[model samples]
Target: MSRLTAAEQKALAERVLDIESRAVSALAGRLDDSFAKACQLCLDLTGRVVVTGMGKSGHIARKIAATLASTGTPAFYMHPAEASHGDLGMITGQDLMLAVSNSGETQEVITILPLVKRMGAKLISMTGKPKSTLAKAADVHFDVSVEEEACPLNLAPTASTTATLAMGDALAVALLESRGFTAEDFALSHPSGSLGKRLLLRVADVMHSGEAIPMVTADVSLSAGLVEMSQKGLGMTAVVDQQQHILGIFTDGDLRRTLDSGVDVHKVPMAEVMHRNCKTIPVDILAAEAIHVMEEHKINGLLVINEDGVLVGALNIHDLFRAGIV
Candidate 1:
């Protein structure tokens, strides 16, 4: 086997990247009124987007559909060959069909065109040949034609596939803007993900509530408060009023500071030592917001209070960590 020199390898890699990147960027010139029309159609889709394609275009179509669904566009991939075998039942008249075929002719895909038309499903096509039958039949046609393939033979799907993938991105992002989809909407589609934890899980979802809450009255001795803190294991306890309103918070750090100052834990009132203006968070606030509050106040735990300013519960950082919300 002949070995390539360093310059030879570098030039080949640069040429491949240059060709593929150009295939993607050249799409910008093609993004005119039709691209806008495509986005408008997907945005107005009351039903799911049914994405279909043939050969390498099918692979790209599947990825494009996944990206659309993950970014708040309702979409799913449907194989055209499978459609003949009864997968067409999955599509409805209200659905939009996005078909992809580079040659603008794939017997399997073209065969289903009549069925989709008969069902009254809206049809969008992506093809390299604008004059192809697929493009002629489509309600919207996204041209993914490339000047040349990255493959030296110019036969394999290299530059064409890259252009198709980028066009799919353009469609998904355009639709995303028209829909006003936010991170919160994206998180709902990915509930088990870290993004969901940061966006969806509120303080009330993971906070200790009801009997698990650690509470100690203002008149309670420091030793008794310490016992409550230890038993609850929250590192802190709320000091409440007769009406159950939060008065202050006594924490382990406060206890340590008091001991160092030679204050009498047994005789001195705990009220004088506790933090009067402790950090408090409402139950409805996001757990990520609660983390910001704790960081800003230099506190590990916070008092959960209702609109009436009554102490409802107590929770610490460990709770959030355990709940996978931190």
Candidate 2:
């Protein structure tokens, strides 16, 4: 055996990519009424989309099922062999069956078709051979045929699998659009992920309120405000009035400025040193949005207020980081 030279290897890799790219592009022309029908079947399903296949096709089927489930379609992949072994009980008449087999005659998948049909499930097939038994048996057939595999002997399932995956993506995205699925909906399905945290976690959910908030009356001495800030460990304190209305904010930076100006910290009032027009965010906004506001203003902390302009909560850059919003 001999290894190809670097230049030869690069050329071979490019050729393979080009072949797979063309195969996926060709599927655009194959989209027809059958594709629409398949999408409609999935859209109308009240039960889960049951995806099944064998061998390499089964791998692609699992990925397709995941994509569908994440993008607002309820779906799961069932191994054909397992389905034949009483797992077929998972499928219901309200479900839609999506079967994948490049040759359209994998014995395991073919053997379970009748049982799926007898359950009155709508059948959709993805195959490289349109005339094969699996394609003919399905109520809707998606042609995933490729000109040839990227393999030298054209035996490997390369281009065909790429085409099949692309078609599956198309179906999932079409259904996603028809259902008016939003990024918030996707975030809900992925609640444990960083994107979900950014989209779903609100300001009030992670903010320090009541006794946890570092606040002082506007009439308090600057020295007292600094003590409140230090005790709260948030590096800042909100200066509020008797009615709990935010008058201003005093942070570590304001303390530094007061020291430089040679003001009497013990005698001067907090209202004299606090930033009267400091940034404030609504309690109902997303924590991600609060981070944006902090970044835009070059501030380290924010005062959360309600619609009536009463101080409700307080948060800082560290809080956002702790909440996985930063």
- State every prediction's TM-score relative to the real structure: 0.88, 0.92
| RMSD of each candidate relative to the true structure | 2.6, 2.2
**Worst 10-residue lDDT window, candidate 1:** 263-272
Residue-by-residue lDDT tens digits, candidate 2, 1-326 = 65999899999999999999999999998778987788888888889999999999999999999999999999999999998899999999999899999999999999988888888998999999999999999999999999999887899899999999999999999999999999999999998789999999999999999898999998889989989998999999999999899889988888888899999989999988998987889999989999989889898899999999999999989988988887
Q: What ranges in model 2 sit over 4 Å off?
A: 307-309
Looking at model 1, residue 172 earns an lDDT score of: 89
Clashing pairs in 2: none
Candidate 2, overall lDDT?
Answer: 0.93
Kindly report which residue pairs in candidate 1 clash with one another.
Answer: none
lDDT for each of the candidates?
A: 0.89, 0.93
> Model 1: per-residue lDDT, tens digit, 1-326?
64998899889889989999999999898877888788888887889999999889899999999999999889999999999999999999999999999999988899999989998989999999999999999999988999999898999999999999999988888788788889889899998999988899988888888878888788877877888888888998888888889889998888899899997677776677778988899978899998888888788999999988888877788988887877
**Candidate 2 lDDT for residue 161:** 92
Which model scores highest in lDDT?
Answer: 2
Instruction: State model 1's lDDT.
Output: 0.89
